[model samples]
Target: MPSDSALPQEDLAVRLRDGDADALAAVYERHSRLVHTLALRALGNHHDAEDVTQQVFVAAWRGRHNLDPGQGPLAAWLVGITRHAVADLLAQRARTVRNLHAVAAQPAEPATASLDGAVTDRVVVAHALASLGEPRATILKLAFAEEQTHEEIARRLDLPLGTVKSHIRRGLLQLRENIRGVRADAS
Candidate 1:
């Protein structure tokens, strides 16, 4: 296989599907920052945004195999997930704020520390990426950082369309594994 940095999405996906841990690492390295930014912009704070970003990637890994490469690139899909998670987080915050404000005399719950913990959870996601190895990591970067479509990646790397699809599917599985590994280490 080519160096993770040099391989295209399809190739990375294939490696990921085959259970290459390196692929997952590449994905995280490439896209985690973008996801974090998207989450932050929507949630309006470093912590909530960070939490949402981690959630977005976790959700993506869970549904990676089912993703259709032709529908769009991974970054677009991740952005969609970030949007949904952010909306959910905002709604939850709004509800909490409204309920607290409604009782003007009642003492508010001590949630400041908890919210900070939420932010920490997101930063941990990068640590999780460390367990993964190559192509998946690289491919993910290509999809998110570069926002390259399968066709574009194919043209850039001179690979077949089928290859690109394989990289994404496999890459997702590798990501799932990496997340699991992160949890295990945490426990």
Candidate 2:
């Protein structure tokens, strides 16, 4: 019997679509290097390319039921998924860069004459964040300071996706109320 690794790409695609996990593995073995190289070239970073390659395989496995053997080679489909993953990662990077630049370009003062106003606000916010305690504070820091997506935070913290999101929402509201208290105190 021919191993799946030796099967034709179309056969492998069919096998994968029919829920053969081994076929997915075979598909990875057959075209992984091609996927990695293309991702590396487009992303221009070996690490990111590797990440995208992994993402491509994972996505392929999950979306296998949609696989049509007639839609050209499986390699083409993998490449399409790779393109989307790379584009998404690139867009995220661009957004982060723009946000950092906007923050950097902001005037130092907090629209107040006092030199320490901005510092005070930062300290207050930091304290407020810290007051959330434990996982809530850590989650918010990961979400805002580190600019991690909820999925990333969920994976890193080993929390449920919905739980991570809830923490962020509640944390933000608490921070807002904290700031309101600060403003009232200052006045």
Candidate 3:
């Protein structure tokens, strides 16, 4: 039997369009390394790159019906998906950073003593967020600053619901520790 790699691109495209998991696997085998390299170069981190690579293939498979064998090679189509995924990752990272800064630097109310205390608390929370990194920082910002529900955060971030929840839980714990330390140091 001919290996999947030997099969014509048109045949593979048709197989993929028909929802053949094997064809998707073959397509992934042929192009996943390219996707990973592109993601890694764009994201500059191994975990995010790997996540984008998986997301690229999953997005391609989910949208297989739209794949046109006549337009171009499957690899090119996958590359396009990878580009979108990378763009999304970067955009999300930027938004997370912005939210963290906003939360950290938010002005306190006009009340004198309360304003000082509120500003100090925001600063502590922001410091903790900056230390959490990536999705964790992002998740916490969405949950706390934006007051988004866990499901809303997961949907917006394209993360699993459980992952979003876990990040929020851990972030809150870390934030508490950091705040405690900050208070201890002040005293």
Candidate 4:
């Protein structure tokens, strides 16, 4: 049997079946930043995001036994957890808004500030990039952070030229979608 270090998460799950705190810690370390970013985007408040991040990991750890190796990478599972946690925060916020609006004498027009929620939007973008697995994540970071060309990315990752282009295109699309959603929610 290979050591946990030598095996993928599927095998790690087996080693953790009976209960290994280390496995849970490793998973948290690997994916927590991604989860935190997702939560921050959803909630738009750092304090709330931090609390929700803890909840997301707790849920994942408690449900670790149900993980399916064939389905996907553990990161995807964590992303799902992050999404749900954010949704929960959104729902709660909506409830509070509804309650507050009911008592307000005059509803202020929703602020149409030009720079509305830009910070939160950036945090969301940072989180989304962090969530992406390596090669994809590394490719994106290089493409965006350094304004590297597709050829440069290929050279850095030693991947095929086509693969580099595909990654950048796909990553940009995803980032656009994610940022749009975050902005919409923030407003």
Best by lDDT: 2
TM-score, structure 2 vs. true = 0.68
- Cα RMSD (Å) between model 3 and the true structure? 10.4
Best by TM-score: 2
Candidate ranking under TM-score, highest first, comes to: 2, 3, 4, 1
**TM-score of model 3 (CA atoms):** 0.62
TM-score of each: 0.50, 0.68, 0.62, 0.50
Q: Kindly list the per-residue Cα lDDT of model 1 for residues 1-187, writing each as its tens digit.
A: 5787566766665555455568666766777899998887776777566667777767777767765655666567678878888888777668657855775667755666697666666666555444445555565557656999866776777766545646655665676677777678878
- In the range 43-121, model 2's lDDT, one tens digit per residue, is 8977678778888998999999888999798989998999999998788679757866986897875455676766787
What value of lDDT does candidate 4 attain over all alpha carbons? 0.74
Q: Rate the local accuracy (lDDT) of all candidates.
A: 0.68, 0.86, 0.85, 0.74
* Residue range 44-75, candidate 3, lDDT tens digits: 98767888898998899899999989899888
Winner of 2 and 4 under lDDT: 2
C-alpha displacement of 131 in model 3, angstroms? 24
lDDT, model 2, position 23: 90
Candidate that beats the other on lDDT, 3 or 4, i.e. the better one? 3
Q: List the residue pairs that clash in candidate 3.
A: none
